[model samples]
Each structure stands twice: as structure tokens, then as C-alpha cells.
Target: MSHFESCWNPASPQALQRRAALLERIAALRALEDRAAAASARSQAVFDKRGQLLPRQRVALLLDPGRPWLPLATLAGYGQDTPELARSVPGGGMIAGIGWVSGVRCMVVASDSGIEAGAIQPMGLEKILRAQEIALQNKLPFLHLVESAGANLMRYRVEGFVHGGSLFRNLARLSAAGVPVITVQHGSGTAGGAYMPGLSDVVIMVRGRSRAFLAGPPLLQAATGEIATEEELGGAEMHTQVSGLGEHLAEDDREALALAREVVAQLGWAPPEAPPAFAEPRYPADDLLGLMSDDLRQPVDMRELMLRLVDGSELLQFKPLYGAATVCAQARIEGRPVGLISNNGPIDVAGANKATHFIQWMCQLGHPLIYLQNTTGFMVGKDSEQGGMIKHGSKMIQAVSNATVPQITLQCGASFGAGNYGMCGRGYAPRFLFSWPNARTAVMGGEQAARTMQIVAEAALARKGLAPDPVRAQAQFEQTVALFESQADAFHTSGLLLDDGVIDPRDSRAVLAQCLALCADAEARRLRPLSFGVARM
Candidate 1:
């Protein structure tokens, strides 16, 4: 009792008041921290609901783990008159920086929708343009995580006017300078100003979350009296399958980021002087003969074949979803970055248009092209006719012809009709046009050929007063072995040099790697002007 009384008597009123105030201040600070944490959590939840991911998460997933992200402009929007706007649109809706992707230092821009709906404001546009300028100056590969609502209408109204011409001009200059630009659509990218991602060398969309269109549904309805859902208007399915806008589609944000990393791996560190070398152990030691099958019409998932061929699981595919029939990707064979284009069978006109755009961009980026041919032809039907297949298909052919990269063609199965030309056929004269033994090259598939032969044989037999034996008539047309083989032989004998020789499908990686190594020192040539518009997004 004596010790308690003495301690109670020691504290004065002033001292007690000071202690209480300190405690209150500490409590307030804790509360503020809690509020910040809760806001961050809510933002993350929004991304989760859309099956999308935050910029930080995308950076972590796409880049090498543990590498520091040296942000370019964390306080981008914090200018004298725009303090409130900065607070509202922190980082200008974009998280841009130099980061390590699998140890490759590159410039990356990740869009953050938490601020200003990820719209491109004056400050945001300036931030991106500055980042791009840095990338170009440093000769670094540019990776864009696009989730914009296009231009900010509110900001534009406040500013009187906003012009995208400067942004497009800079992108065009960067592209012309040969910097590889890769884009991933993490959310809706719409309107006239959204074309930046479209103009990139490669574009990958996350299935449900990503969409690219010239306008939103409301705008479309206002303009054309067309009322449609977002999915039908510009979802990943629509863009990839119908609009010819997106290049590839992923199952989710994680996969999209993973694919982006793979794309960077394929590109390697760039100077464009020498292609990267593939790891030696990754090459197939045995001939790849067994990998081929005789069935021409069978659909082999080229994606699987590519994964097996590239080094270190580095098959970076572009526009995997949009052109369901055509496969375009980036990959490394023994470490060399190569552009891969393959047939996914019958894709619509939109797919063809996207494919053409992709190939043109690759050529402009100064990357070599690898063609894997196995297409029947372009899609045909009322829908295709209306979609302008001829115009788009012609564009693809023109792009292929104009490509100055060291082009290599691998005929895996059927390379029929215009599909062959689009895939760098003998006419385009790829540096090396190799074929698997199972390849069937012709104006059309054997079935169509057989039908034409049947009609001709039937007419001849009827004129000869002999019944056309349906069996023998078909047998006479069974020149699958002779005709295609002769075609292959003719390609070789014409001194047109069909291929180095027929290769096993499994050994494609090894063959391509060796060819790339041989051509690494080849001079980079410029393709003719195929695009009038600047690359935008």
C-alpha cells in the first residue's frame, strides 16, 4: 500500500495529459495505415472479380522474381496545378518502369485501373510517352499491360482539347527504330485512341477480361443504331474471332503474364545485331520423323509442337485466340529469337487480317520469321465473304512477300491454296522451305483434287462407252503419293531449292536453330512501306 501511494503521487496533471496525447496520436497513425491497407485490398478485389490482375502482380509474374522494379514516374501526375488530379489518378493509371524479365532488363508499362478507370488522361499520356521515349533511347524491349478505357473524356473536356497525333508519332518513330513492342490486354481497350496496343508487334488478351474495339457499346449504338453486348461487341472471343483486332487470348491474367514473359524470353536482350543462341541440350538429338502422321486433315495442336521445339519452354505465342486458324508466336531455338507463324486450319477473315498485321509488325521489328504451314485455306461462307476475306488474305500475302527477315518455312501437313502463300510458300521464296515427309503441298487438299479427277475420269469413261468403275475411277485419282511427291521433287529440282531437305517434325527446333545461327550475321533489310498508320495503343 505504501509503494502504490508513492507511485500515484509522482505523476503531475501536465505530464499525464502529455502521455494521453501521445497515445492518441499513435492510435490515429495506426488507423490511417489500416485505411490505406483496406483501400489496397479493395482495389485488389476489383481486379480479382474481373479475373484480371493488378499492375504490381503482373510485373511480379512476368518479370524475374526478386528483381527490383525501378519505376520511371511514381509521381507522374503531381504537377503544380494538378495536385488533386494526381491524388485521384495516382501514377496516371500506369505503373511504368525498367524491370528484369527472366534477367532481361526491359521497359514495362502496367496499367492500373484503380485510378481514373485506367483512362488515358493528359498526364497519363505524357507519362507513357516519356516511358516509350526512354525505352527507345535505351534500346530496350517495351512490354505494355494495356487496360485503358481509351482517352479520358472528362480530362479532355477540362483541357479544351486532346490530341493523339503526338503519341502516335512517337510510337511510329520507336517502331521505325526497331524496338520490339509487346502488349497484353488486361481489360477493356476501346475507342479511336485505343489503337496503340493494336499497333504493337504482339498483342495477347486475357479471355473474359480483355476486349479491344473501336468504340464501346453505347458509342456503337449511338453511331450505327447497333445494340450489342460487350462480349458480342469486343470481348476476347469477338476480337480474336470476329474483329481481327486481338492477336492472342489467354485463359486468365496469370497465363497472360506468363505468355508475356515467354515473349520476352523469345526476344532475349536486344541490339538486333546478333540473335540469341539456344541452349544446346534443348535440341532434339534424333531425327523427328516419328512425330509426323499421314492423316492430312487431322488437326495437330501446333502449340504443343512449338513448346516441344523451343528451348526452355519459351514459346511466346501472339494472337492465339483472334486468328483461331493461324498461329503466331515468338520463340527461341537454341537461344535465337524467331517469329513463328503457323496455320490453325480455317479461320475467318478477321483472323487473316490480324495475322497480316502481326507478320508486318514482326518484319518491321527486324525479327526473323518461321512459318509452320498446315492450313486448308482461308475461311469461306457468307460470313467470310462479308468479312472481306479476299482483302485481308491479300494483305497477309503482301506482308509475307514484303518481309525482309530471314524467312524459313516448315510444311508440317497440308499447305493448300492461298494459305500456302500466306505461310511463305515456294512463291515467297523463304530462305529455306523444308517439309516433313507427311506434308501435302498443292492448290487444294487431296479430297478436292480427287473430286475434280473423278469428274474428268467419269466424262472420259462415258465417252469411251465403258462404265466408270467408281472404285477404279477413284483409284486412278489416287495420285496422292505421286502428285505430291512430284510436287516436292519439282520444288527441289527447279533449283528453286524447296528445302535444305525433308526434316523430322521433332527436329524442327534443331534445324531452325542451326539455320538461325547461320543467318544471324545476315544484314537486316527493310521491308517496303506496308502500313500508312502509325502503331498506336
Candidate 2:
């Protein structure tokens, strides 16, 4: 047995110093997350007065207790509404994730009604759209604990209104695809938002609180000169008893959540398949916390990561000595067959060729592929070009695009340039993609980009027969680096929904297991298709 030797020294001063810095970065991020949570918690008092549960409380009630909840895009609108990053609360005005509901995994979306009366924030619409997409793709039943003030008309943009239609369209698509959507309209779903409940497979409404109307009283009075009370127009009782828009009517938040969970259980979902015999990793999961580095330029030992991830920490490295940068290994994560591709450095001609072969091999074996991305991209310069880097790289990409298997990607560090494409970045449509908080994704490293710009500027100056000012050039380089670095950070990428979410390193194994199970179940379950989605009665 060729067991991998450990070179990591936790007791070394350099290791401690690096960890301390990384911890501070992690803590600062956690502090911002805490602030966002506290902001929502503060509004619990207001919810209590109104005989309603807070948004998170509703999610908690909806989900099966003690089941894992994998929250996504917690920083969706961070640093958007204000310049103060610390003061600006993200979460896109919603709480959304995958969790167990009625012993079945489901995609749960809840309005942060406690804050801003659940009014959608800057990027809130985009966040929900991504969440909807995940649910549709994963075939998870959708449960919505909704109470939104709809779009902020005062700060409305035409683009937001135009794109918002997809949210409804996706709901219909989810139903057509045999995925169930269960909604609980805890409050307003006015104007265009009325379609939310209208499009769902099943909808639950709170007796007096839930409202689903094309227009509110003021708009009804203005448009048709019809003076109607809130209940007369779109109240929960009217929808359930008269309008037929809502299927189930509940007295309050708790009851509404209960109905949503019950609906999930009644959706004809298949029970989980018994997994293969699993073994715990020989290494501690806590080691993952210190495994990652905030500096993207630093190299990561793929073998070490694999040791901590796979069953028994036992890995069969494929071509260990050849194509050394691109590390391919056969292993079982949770005892299910999986092939892993990770980077020790950039992808050169040999590495790309090796990966191409490995991807094909994995597909033939009917094993899912897991990509641990940490590359600066394919090798550049004269030596690489002469070695047929382009040819080999193209071959790898073709294999990745055509491979018939589930591919999951985790951005543990820099996922830059063509490396991102080859390794299944967001564009490649990996079944699932997640990122570590310390990870960064961009066309290239910030320093690399800035230096490239500097060279271009120097050449432009040479063409003009003018010498560039050293001071000005240095300033420009600094500014360029700062902008790129900030935008490439996980917080910024996650806010834009570039990846599923920014996850803590410690939770990596659990997250991957959940995803693996979901993918496996999807592959196994049979679907019944009709020409169109289930129509409203």
C-alpha cells in the first residue's frame, strides 16, 4: 500500500502565522454573516406582535429537525445598497437552501419578512432565480415561505421587472419537469407576483395574512375605480374559498409550514437508496480548516485533500508520476464510486492529455467526477506552446463537455482562465458547483492582470515616443490589482450567483455527500412526463 506521507506542520511558526491570518479573514466574513443574521433576528419582536413567525423560524419549522441545512448565497447583495461593507446586510432579502422536509430533501425559500417587510433587495430577484434553477435541475420539491412587498417601485429598474418573469416561468418549468412546487403565501403576492401561487403545484395560505392579487386596494381604486377591501381583493380566505388560487388554508405560520412539509411528503418522492459501505477518512475534518490558504497564488497538495475526503483516506492515484500537475485519482466518497481531478499547478500539455484520458475513463466506469480547482490556467510561454498545450487543452475540454456522468466542482483556490473552463466552472454546467470563502475566480490572478496591463501601457507609450511616468504607472497598477482582487473574492462571486454558495471549509465533506446523494437519486429515479405541466383547477 502506497500511503501518502504528510508534509504539513501544524506546530511550525510559519504554519501558525498563516493560519492566524486566514482565521482573521474567516472571522471577518463570519462577523458580517452574523450581522446579517442579527439584523433579521431583531425583527422577531415585530413578528411576535403580528402573530407571525420570523422568516428563519418558519424555515426551521418547515424543515425536519436535526437534518442538515445547506444555506446558499448568504452574501447575495452584500456591499450593494451602501458603501459600508460591515453595515450592509446581504442575503438578498431571502433565506434559501436545501434541507430535509418531511424526511425528503427539498429546496426551501423563505422571505426575510421581518426585515423591510420582506421587500426584495437589490439582487434578491437574481438570488431566488438561481435557487429556483437549482430546485428544477436537482428535481427537488420547492417550498416557499413567502411574504414579499414585491419590487421596490421607488427604486425600480425596467430590467428587474423584465427579468422577473423568468421566476414564474421556472415555476411552470419545474412542474413540467416533474418537480413539485409547494408555496405558503404568508403575506402579499401582489401585481405580477400573484403568479407565484398561481404557478405552483400546491399553495398554502395564511387565513388573514396571505394576499395574492393583481392589484392592491389603491391600485384597484385607481385602475377600475373599484373600492375593494384587502380581503375582498386577494385575501387568503377569498383565495382558498372562492378564487381557487390557493389549495390549503392555514391559521398561522406554524400551521402553514406544517402544510408545506406535508405536501412535500405527499409528492410521491422515492425513498433514498441504500448507499455502498462507507468508511470514515483517516484524517480529521478539522484539518480542512487549515488546509486552505487565502492567497490564491499558493499551491495546494491535491493528495492531502483527497486523503481527507475519500473513504478510508485510501486513493488509487492514476498516473501519479506522469502529468504531475493534473492529479487524477480513483476513490470512493461515502463509499460511492467517484473519480477526482485536482491541480497541483497549471495544466500543461502532458497534464491536459492525462486529464482527457482520465475523464473518458471515469465516464466508461460510470463514476461521477469531482473537480478540485486551484489552477492559474493552462501553461503559457514558448515551451508550453511548442509542447502542443493548445491541442491537449482542447482535447481535455472536449472530453469534459461530452462525458456522460455527473461532474461536481469545488473552487478551493484560483480558478482562472481556460483552467476554469476545463475544470467545469459555472459556464460548463457542472451538476453542482461550490466555493470556499477564501477562493477566488477570475480570468487570471489580480497581479497577473495588473502586470499585463502595465506591459500594454508601456508599449502604448513607446508607440507615442513618450516615457511613462513611474509614479502614475505604479498607482494604476495598484488600483487595477485592488479592483480585480475585490471582484474575484468569493463574497463578490457568490453575490452574483457565480457559484452555488460560499461554504466553510469544515463543512465541505457533508455538503459534497448531500450533493452526491442527490445526483445519484436523480440518476436512479424514473420520471413521468406529460405534454404540459399540471394546470390549475
Candidate 3:
């Protein structure tokens, strides 16, 4: 490893402008996250009367103090709930992340029950399912904080109802795969929501607050003509003592969370293995804010950003001068050996071929691959076509698809076309994928997409021996541009579950370090598979 000298000038005008731009975007991102918290906080008086801890408070209590929590899909359902951005509450009404609880790294999925009484929102289902997917893939224990009003009937999508079954199925699958599924029912978990606790390997329910029944009084009475109080039906005590459902019962929210943590502590799960010796990056992580520009076309040195990520800012360049656009290197993050592939510009033929070889090499070396994506996509047009862009690009994609290594993608800027595939975008199923606030992703940029549509329309008109209607063509182009621009923004992509979550650029190093460490631990840990899942007594 060679020491990488820093060339990033933070005092430059461009850096100042980039810093200001990044701060504004980060502020906006924080505000959206704050909105979800504020929405949950609004129910505080009600929760206070009920003597309950808020969802966020419960999560805080459940995690080990001072440990990092990587919140996923914070901007989920951003524009979906309403057209007005100000009125939208992101995070799909859920708070989920990878956090440490009782020394075990687990996927903690807490229902944002403070919002809309924790009614299941459209994208909230997707958020939890994605969390389950992460736990399953990484072999992490599944911990669910259950206190939902179940699916929102008023705004229910039948598709959501049809697909929600997978959540329970995943619980069983996780348990069968030797990954424990733990649940703490802080409040109502009626209807399909009951399954979250029922399927878990460990269940801790609050005595008064927890209620996990397939149907509440109204539905129960309407369906079976049976009159019963929620307590008698599925209260914590009743379930624990009579129904053989809940294994442990607690007095309130705090006790329930404590029990959940205690349960995690007793799991005897393997801890993260010791990482290799490493030094901090040479560059200041705070400089990360100024290093990235909002404009994708503007050339930004990805090497400068990578310099701030790897240990001691040391990176051994794989192919420095050749295929310069695509940057590949061997480096250590948080003392974990990994190979990095980044782009300073669009991936051309040589860059694609270089990346292909680097990915395969990383796999052979048994190292994980980290992709710092900031490309407008593969180079196009006549010269590129003659240079075998398609074939070479395919080689990169093939390597990305079958590398047999843990690949993590960070959408730092533009991620478009086959460039996204080559860079290990969401479609390629990287071990984990995340984005920065200013990240932009689409099949192509708005202008390019609009232009392409216009050209196609004009060519079609010419084929019909007709002249293109300029006014109609211009109107269509504007709409296409607007649509693509809005949808490609990080908020939209994150809401659609395109990336794991949008993160603050300043926290990239810490986040990457944690994730890389987790990937390493997962690779080394072994699990005892069983013929059947561990069932509750």
C-alpha cells in the first residue's frame, strides 16, 4: 500500500460553492427525517397518558448505548403519501436500521407507531420487507418492535394486503435458517400484524399495552358474533399464560424493551471478528461535504473522495493511466481488506474492461468490492460503438453479477443505464447499497431522455411523410423532462426502494466502515441449520 497525498483544496471557490450546495441538501434531508420524528412526537401526549415510550425512545432503549445505528429508507414514501412535499412524511412511518443490542448486531425494525397510530402505509410494508431481506442475506438476527394499527384500511392497496404475507413467511424462513427472530409487542398488533410476534422465535409483550389478536373486538364481533374485550382476547398476560403465544410479559414499554434487549443478550450469537490493523484516512472526513458537486457532468475527482475513505488514505491503484475514467484500487476500510471501483466520468470501453478485470480479481482475492458510483453511464456514439463499448460493458456487468464477493454500492452522484449495472446498482443485488443526498438515478438524465423521445417522435413522423408538430412535441418533451428529473432525485429513488437509504455525505466514512465491518463478520460467522425452525413453547 502506498500513501495517497491529498490534492483536495477545501478553501477553493469551487469547494466553497460545493460545500454550500451540499449543506443545503443535507439540511433538506435532515428536515425530512425530522418531519417523521415530529409526526411521531405529536402523539406524545396520548402515549404519555397510556404510560408508554415513543417508538424512537423504544429503539434507543433497545440498542446498546453509543453504538451506531444506520437508518435505512428514511425517505421512503416521500412523494407517495401526498403531492405536496411539505405535507409528506417520509420513512414510510417506520424506523429501521442495523444497530447493536446486547452485543449482537441485529436488524431492528421498529414500527413508527406514533404516526397515524402506526397504520401500515403503502411503502412501510416494503420498508420492513427490505429490512427482513437484509437480515436474511447478512445472517443477522431479526428484531421487530411491534405496535402497529395494522394496514390502513382507508388507504389500503390490495397489493399490499396480498404481499404482506411475505413478512411472516420471512420470519419463519429466518428462524429456519438459524437466524433468531425476536419481537416486542409494545401495543396493538391486530389482524395480519399479529403474525410478527407469532412467527418470531422470541416474543416479549407489554402486559397492558401489548395486544396481538387476529381480530379486534369490532371485527371479532362482526365475524363470529363473539363479544370479548381485547385483554381477554389476546392481552400479553393471556397470551403468555393461556394461549402459549408470548414467552415473556412486561409491565410497560420500557420493561418490554429491556426484556427484548435481555433476550438479545442471551442469544449467544457470534460477535464481529477483530479487524486488521489500520490507520485513519489522511483527509478530513468533514471535507467530504465540499468534495462532491451536485452537477454530474462537472468532473469531480473520485480519488479524492476515496482518499478520505480508506485507511491512512492509502490506495494501490490497479490501472492508473489505462481506463482512467473508471478508477479501481486495493485499499482497507476500517481495517477490512476490500477493492474499490469508482468513476470520475462515464465508463468507456477500456474503463469497463478494466473494471471487469478488477471485480474478478477482487473475488479471487476473497475481498469485498465497494463501488463509488458517480457516472452518467457508459459512453455512447460512433467512436464508442466502434471501440466495443457494448461488449466490454457486458463483461463488467457479468463480473458484477457473478463476482461471488460482497459488493456494496454508494450512489454518490449520477447512476444511469448499463453504467448502474456495471457499477453494481440495486438491480444487481449488491450486498448493500446506499446513496448520498444529492445522488441522482434514472434510466437516463431528464434532458437526455426527453431528447431521445423527441428524436424518436420526429423520426416516426418523417417515416409517415409528415412534419413533426413543434408545439405538441415541445409539450411532450417538457413533461418527460419534468417526470424524469423528479423521479430520479434521491428521495424518489429511495422511496421506491432503489437504494438502502439516502445518507449525509459527512457520515459516509463511518457508515462505510460499519457496513464493511459487518460484511466481514458475516462472512466469518457460521450458523447451525436445522430441519425446522425453532418454535415457541
Candidate 4:
């Protein structure tokens, strides 16, 4: 054979080494491609099953469609010796980065269950903390898609002993910064640290899937005699109704994501948008005054009234299941964003808790607030007291006071006592406060006032030698119409602006739009500062 023919032969050691090296390199590249494909497939499976967009998907939905998510730590956990516990924990469980949501920029942490059942290990916590820090430093909104079995059990013996406190500290700092944290409980969230979701400004739960709690049922049973199912302990219903842990319950994953997107859209990454300028009045003259009920004592569904007033079906109610009595939501008036806080008139304590949560969320978002006054008052009694209504109520009040957003009050009906103040009374100084002609502003309802006056009359009769005459008493009360009129005067002239002039219910939307437009320019000037501190979880 010729020298060239011999050189081409496969039996030669030099040629053999060359072939082996090429094959080895090809194998390695193929292996890498397969791994990537596997990860993509795994993420897809999660999305398909739950109708969930991964953390990346969420960022895409929230951020402008084309912005790239700049990962904080792409190779966060790839070199550790413990394959299961180290290299995969951080990047695999929590995918965090700075990205744009709509055009608004934000930092987001998404859970990846393909890695260790989406457990939060020490490294995972570190990644989250770092991302939170970035968000706070940049004054960006922080979005967390919480889906984990709390802390990782495998690393408990090693990490639990050393860095357990770090996670909570970081969570607290993010909260303290007023970063406008939004948490979507996508799946199982339990234990002490998992409750971080509760500390967020808005906590959204997936209807039948997502759950959150300080501890699971078994743990609760072990600590105390109380035994309940997972759903009973920390499911969507329990959190929204019993503990007020979740601020919003979505019908499903898509609905939850849509709500999140809507919330973020309304609340841009930085300071909130000013209320829009008033467009031409939308409601007819008759519809403007029609919302007010003549019978002050009769309960009216404020939600219906809000629906009629807000532009389009743009009203987004928050925590509806939690606070049925206090309706808190975000709505558009003539296309201007405004926070709506109204009374459900007759709802349970759970409903009040939800309302409190919704209002707090709105305040945190810095959206302009609108109060649809109609409340007998907060639910009273021992049961309510036990549920920490006072504490939660105080939180609601603080949220209102701390809100830098402009506020406007619309006294639709009964504005009684503390409820009036809590719903942004004239004392709160809404930019422009108006009341419907039928509104009654007082410490209590007119009927109650009349009854008290009747009691006084009866006592006077008892002192004399005469029985209280029902017919005469009734006539005397009617003649004392001045008592009712005084309430209106006190509300308007004595600072409540009773003379602010009764707005026609139909004209209310136009008035609100005008208020929003008037404030919009000023609100744009308010820049949100980067403030970070620890939070109570």
C-alpha cells in the first residue's frame, strides 16, 4: 500500500486517537443538549398541568414582551459536591432575575419544581435574598412565585444548623423596603419560612391548587390537639376566609396569573400613575343619584354601586372572599385608576379581614383611593375580637394613613361612627369629598338616634306622673327633624363638607374622573425611593 493509503487506515494509533477524541467531544455536546431539552420539557410539563407560566413566563407577562431577563446568578448552584442538595438547589428551585414586566422593570423569583420538589435550600434562600436586595436597591417591584415544600429536608441537618435565620431576615428586609412585593402561591407552601408569602403586599392563591401556612396539618396536630386537613389548615379558602393570609383567590392558575398581570399593570414598577383626568360624565343624571338608598338603615350592596360607577367592567375586586363586608378593589373611573373601599353592610368577620387586606394592598400599590361609604360599622362580638380584628383593623387604618396616594370620599349612604373614619371620612381629607343627598353621616343610624331620644323621653315621663304616650312621642320625634339635619350640617360644615354638595350618582363617575385627572400630573412627580427594612412574617 502507498504511504497516503496507510495514513488513512483506522488501525493507526494517531488516527485512532483523533477519532476517539472527536467522538468523545460529540458525546459531551449531545449530553449537554439533552440536559437542556430535559429541563425545557420539565418546565413545559409544569405549565401544561397547572396552566401556570413559570417564573420566566410570569416575567415575560409582566415585563415588556421582548425584554431579556438578566439572571442574577445563572450558575448559582452548579459546582457543589452534594449533587442533589447543592448544585441544583438554587438555580433549579428558584429562578430569579431582574426583568421587565410590561414595560415596567422588576425583580422576580420563580419556583422550579423539577429540582428537589421546589424546596428552598440555603443556596436557594441566598439567591432569593440577593434578588430582593437588587429590587430594593433599584426601586423595582419584587414578584415571587412561591411553590415549595418550605425548606429542603435533605439539607436540614447541614443547613438548618447554620443559615436558618438568614432567609427570614432577607424576607423582612424586602418587606421593610416597601418594594411592593407580589407573591403568587403556585403550589404547596408551608412551615414558618413559607409564610413569607403572607408578608407580601398582594398574596394570590390558585383556587384549588396553591396553599400556604405556618405549619402543615400534621405539624399543627403534633404541636396542639387541633387536627385539620391540608385545605382546612392552609388552603385558599382558609387563608382567604379564616386567617386572611391570601389577599386574592383566583379561579385557576390562568386567572391568578391574569390578576397578577392586571395588578402589576395598574401598579407600574415605580411610583403609581396619577388619577386620570375626568372624561366627560358617563352616567346619566338619573343614574348619578340613584345609587343612594332612601332608608339609611337598609343595607345596600356597595359592589353593585361601584360596578355601575366604574368605567367598563374594569373593577378588579381584591380579597373578595375574605372581607365580604368591606369591599376593596381597584377600578377605573373614566379610564382613570382608583382604589375603591366600600362597605358590604352585612358580612362576617372573615369578610372584614379580607377588606382590611385589600385596602392595605391598595395603599401599598400607591393607587388613588375612593371610599364608597355605607357601613353600620365593623363586625362586633367576642368571635371578631378573638380573630384579631382590632389589630387587622389598625393595620388597615395605618395603610390608609401611610398611603401617599390621593383619596376621594363618596358618601353613598350610612356613614356611621368609626366606619366613616376608617373609610376615609372628611377627617382624612380626601382631595374632594362629596355625598349623595340621601347620605346620613352620624355616630349611629337615624333610627338608633330616634330610639335613644325616645328612651330619654320615656325616662322623663317616668319621673313625672304620666305614662309615655307612643302617639305623642312619635309626633315629637318627627318634629325634631332638626336632629337629623344637624348631622348633615356637621358632616358638611363642621369639616365633613356636608355642603360639599350632594353629587348625582350618575355624575359621580364624571366627578371621580375629573378628580383623578386633576391629581394625575402631581402624582407623576412623586418618585418612589428605595426603602428596604426587615418585615414581620
The TM-score obtained by model 2 is 0.97
| Tens-digit lDDT string for candidate 2 (120-170) | 776888888988888877778888888988888988989888988988998
* lDDT per residue (tens digit) for residues 439-482 in model 1: 66777765677777788778898899988876776566776535
lDDT of 1 at 255: 88
Cα lDDT over the full model 2? 0.86
Better of 1 and 2 by lDDT: 2
- In order, candidate lDDTs are 0.65, 0.86, 0.90, 0.62
Model 1 poorest 10 in a row by lDDT: 1-10
Which candidate number would show the highest lDDT if scored against the true structure?
3
Off by over 4 Å in 3: 469-472
TM-scores, all candidates, are 0.44, 0.97, 0.97, 0.43
Local lDDT at 162 for model 4: 55
Per the 3 Å backbone cut-off, how many clashing residue pairs does candidate 3 have? 0
Model 3 superposed RMSD (Cα): 1.4
Candidate 2, position 9, lDDT: 62
